[model samples]
Structure formats: C-alpha cells, structure tokens
Target: MDDGFIAKPLGRRQIDQAYPLVCAIAPGLGVDQWRAFAAALLGTAPKGSGPGSSGPPAEAGIITVQNALGYMHGLFSYRVEPNLRHGRVLSVDNFVVLDLFDLAGIAETLLRAMDLLARRLGCAAIHTTLPERYLVRDSRRNPIPDCFRTEGHRQETIRFSKDLAVVNDNAPAVAGGLHGVE
Candidate 1:
C-alpha cells in the first residue's frame, strides 16, 4: 500500500517543519545547529550577501518525503564530491526513516531522488555510508543493498590498521610499510 508520501527538495523556509524530523534522527544536535545546517544545505546566506557569502560553499542538500499528515517520514542528505576514481560522485549521507515504518520503500524513493540529482549534476556514481546499526540489525538492510546492486553498484569491505607505537627493529615490515626495502 502506498503511504501517500511525496518527496522533494527541502527549502530554507521549511526548516521549522523539518527540525523535528532532524531532531528525531540526531537528538544531540541543537536547534541552532539544525538551522545552520539547513542554510548551508539550501545554499542560503543572510540578506544582502552573495551565494556562500556567509561561510563555506554549499556542498549538500536535503531531500524529504512527507506523509499525507504533512509529517516528514523520510529524510536524506546528499553531497556532490569530486572523486579521483569516480569523477564527480554523489554521496548520500545522514539518511533517516521513521522507525515504525518499512524503510525499504522510503529508501528507494530517496535513492531515486538522489539519482536524479546526481544525473543533473553530471555525477558518475553514487556512494553512501551506512551505519553499523542499520548494517547489522535492520531487516531493511537486505533491500537497501539490493537497491544499489540493481543499479550495478558493487560492495567492497575495506580494512585499514596502523601500529602507533614505535616499531621494533626485529619486526619485519610488510610489503608497503615504511621499512620496506625496494
């Protein structure tokens, strides 16, 4: 069944309505911070100032889907990044859906929005970082990856480690370590 939800780009004037949803996702952040985030994302500056005249250049935007009750149920923030490997890439971040709902549908709708934004911006690929909570526990996680897989994206696990202590002379260096002999 459709949830009677509609998705679209969020604007600066809608911050008051959006803040509660933002708080639902990140309770620790203050309301003032949310206001700043909305401004930064929507690329709005104080009156009489030029674009980005307030601070850093706008690098993100929020896409939100609200239900028939006019309550936002899905929220996703995406940014365009120049990547050496993927040219201009769109990175989806800080995605949140109300816990009581099925996330798969909301996620799909949001990704579709992200894809359109990416295409419009000439992005070559889309990337996102999923938290461990979603990755490990949510039943919705399966469909989440499937959404990307259907679009030809592949998943890879990358691991990195460093020894902070001074190395002992007796320890043999790995092939790419500082002590490696060419």
Candidate 2:
C-alpha cells in the first residue's frame, strides 16, 4: 500500500536484496533457504500474468517488500504450512522495518497478502503474530487484521493445538479406561 513499495514474491535478484532484511528478522532461517526464497518469489510476484503470459505459478511462497511514500519502507515475509490439526495456517514469518512507531498500512498489506495466499493454498485457516498495541483497538479488543481475525480475537486468548500420532486406517487403536493400562 505504500505509494512506491511493491509487495511481490522473492526473485533471484530481489532475494539478494531481501537477505539482509530476512537475516535481520529470523537469523535461524540460515543462508541457503534465503537463496531458494529468491528463486520462489519470481513466479509469485503479482504480474496479472497468467496462461497467456506464461504458465501455472510456482510452489509455496512468501510475499516480500513494502513500498511507501516512494521509498522501500519494510518487508513482510509470509508462508503457509500444513497444520495437521485444522489444516494449513499462515505465518508472518518476517515483519521488519517500516515503522515500529507508526503501524499505518501494515495491517492492510498483510491482510491482502493473507487473502491471496490463503485462497491460493486452499487453506483452512490463516495465522500471524501481531504486536500487542495495534493489536488492541481502543485499548480493548485485539484486532488481528481487518482482512482477517481470530474466532474470539481476545488480547490474551490463544488457539490450542495438539499433534496426534497419525495412524493407518487398518490399524486398530483405542484409548482404554484408566484401569486397563495401570
């Protein structure tokens, strides 16, 4: 939404520019993934280009760059991954620069990214980490993103999840009463 900053997928060339920003974010992501990240962004950056323009888009991807006021303001890197529980969920893998003081178009841009990515991935849910302040509207309820919101959208509430052992259909499995195993 920034006047000049465009949010597009990370291409080889752009990825090189994004590495320092990403490293500034989650250093654990390492160097190699950053290289591949650039490769992935090329195909995903919006072009309105489709069949007539080229071919089907590439694999899972992330949105990069935020342009505002004719200069690059920040970067928002996001990706969707399998959630085994309710399905896939979006992660705002990186939220760097822009303005720690003023969160203007941040929400809108993120929402736009999520909407596109969610539909593209056919995901069941969208998710992301929000700062505590802007998250709370009027110092009350937490507003995640105008484009998206949690079920309760409470300040302190969190969605709980569990990882269950995936069992084969033919394998019989059961949870016994307390007396059985003891």
Candidate 3:
C-alpha cells in the first residue's frame, strides 16, 4: 500500500496475479483477512467497476508495487451527470479508500486511487479535504504538489480538480468549450 504502487483494472485472468501484491505488503494479514478482502471484493467487483456493481465484496482496481509494504481493496462508484438543484454534478455514490495494512498505506493508496479515478472518469478535476502531509509533495516546495499546477504535479494537491469547470464555471472560459478545459 505504499503510494508507490501502481493500480490498474484487473480482468478475471489477472486477479490471481494479485496474490503476490497482497501478501507481499501485508505479510501477516492471515486467512481471515484475506478471506474478508476476497469476499468484500467479490461482492464489489464481480464484473467490473460500476455503481451498484455489488456489495461488501466491493469493486475497485487492484494496486500493485513490487516489494510494497501492503496492497489495497478499493471500492468506488459514482453518479455521473447527477441531477443537482440547477444542473448536475458527479457524486461519488460509493467510495472507500482502505489500507489493509499499515496506516501509512492509507495515505499512499488514497492519493494514488484518487489520481487514477480523476483521469479515468475524464473528470476535469478531483478534490479532497485531507490536510497537508496527506498532500503528496514535490520535494516540499511552496505548494509543490498543486495537482495541476504543472506536468507531473497531479499528486501534489488534495483539493484539486481534473477539470476545474466541473466544480466551478468561474475558471477562465475556454474557446474550445469544456473540451479545452484541461
């Protein structure tokens, strides 16, 4: 679960490849823990990533990092274009960032998973309220990790947007419309 791990969607065939990723990190997780994770994931990820996909055996992409201290079981679901008072908003209907091992893993997994979700959903931007060390850093510069301040800076800011327009229209209007937002 070191944030260093890379996560990707797993097809049925590659799920087995996850064993090493799991055991390698939480070496002492035991049968019950594995069973619980398996059960939870089965309930959530039986088919693919989607809202109401399943329950406890939740659904989420697997995180992988060679020699990582732990792995994670992430379950997320969202209401895209959700109806709001005026228009619509993307509400994360179901989202849980869990670290099956050390607490430090929580920081790493949550940060990485959000980063992945923002990009995958074509979100203009993503946001979070976690305090700063929870904020990923770029050598700890003054706002070093502002998520979108520059290339490769996406990991730096917690309260960030994949595309600012999704949250606020006040952003400088783009000529190409929302497509040019990013």
Q: What is the Cα-based lDDT of residue 168 in candidate 2?
A: 42
Give the clashing residue pairs of candidate 2, or none.
2-67, 2-68, 5-67, 9-41, 10-41
What tens-digit string does per-residue lDDT give for candidate 3 at 1-182? 34455444434444454554445435555755655554454454545453212322222333333234334353323332433342433333223333446434433443455555555545554433332333455555432233224424334323533646465755465677765556
TM-score for each predicted model, relative to the true structure: 0.67, 0.51, 0.30
Top model by TM-score, which number?
A: 1
Rate residue 45 of model 1 by lDDT: 29
lDDT of 2: 0.51
C-alpha displacement of 52 in model 2, angstroms? 15
What order do you get sorting by lDDT, best first?
A: 1, 2, 3
Clashing pairs in 1: none
Would you list the C-alpha lDDT of every candidate in the order shown?
0.66, 0.51, 0.41
How high a TM-score does candidate 2 get?
Answer: 0.51
**45-70 in candidate 1: lDDT tens per residue?**
22322121333323467778777776
* Candidate 2: stretches off by over 4 Å: 1-3, 27-33, 36-57, 68-71, 97-102, 129-182
Query: Which segments of candidate 3 are over 4 A away from where they belong?
Result: 1-4, 10-71, 83-90, 97-101, 124-182
CA RMSD (A), model 3: 14.5
Task: State in Å the error of residue 102, model 3.
Answer: 2.9
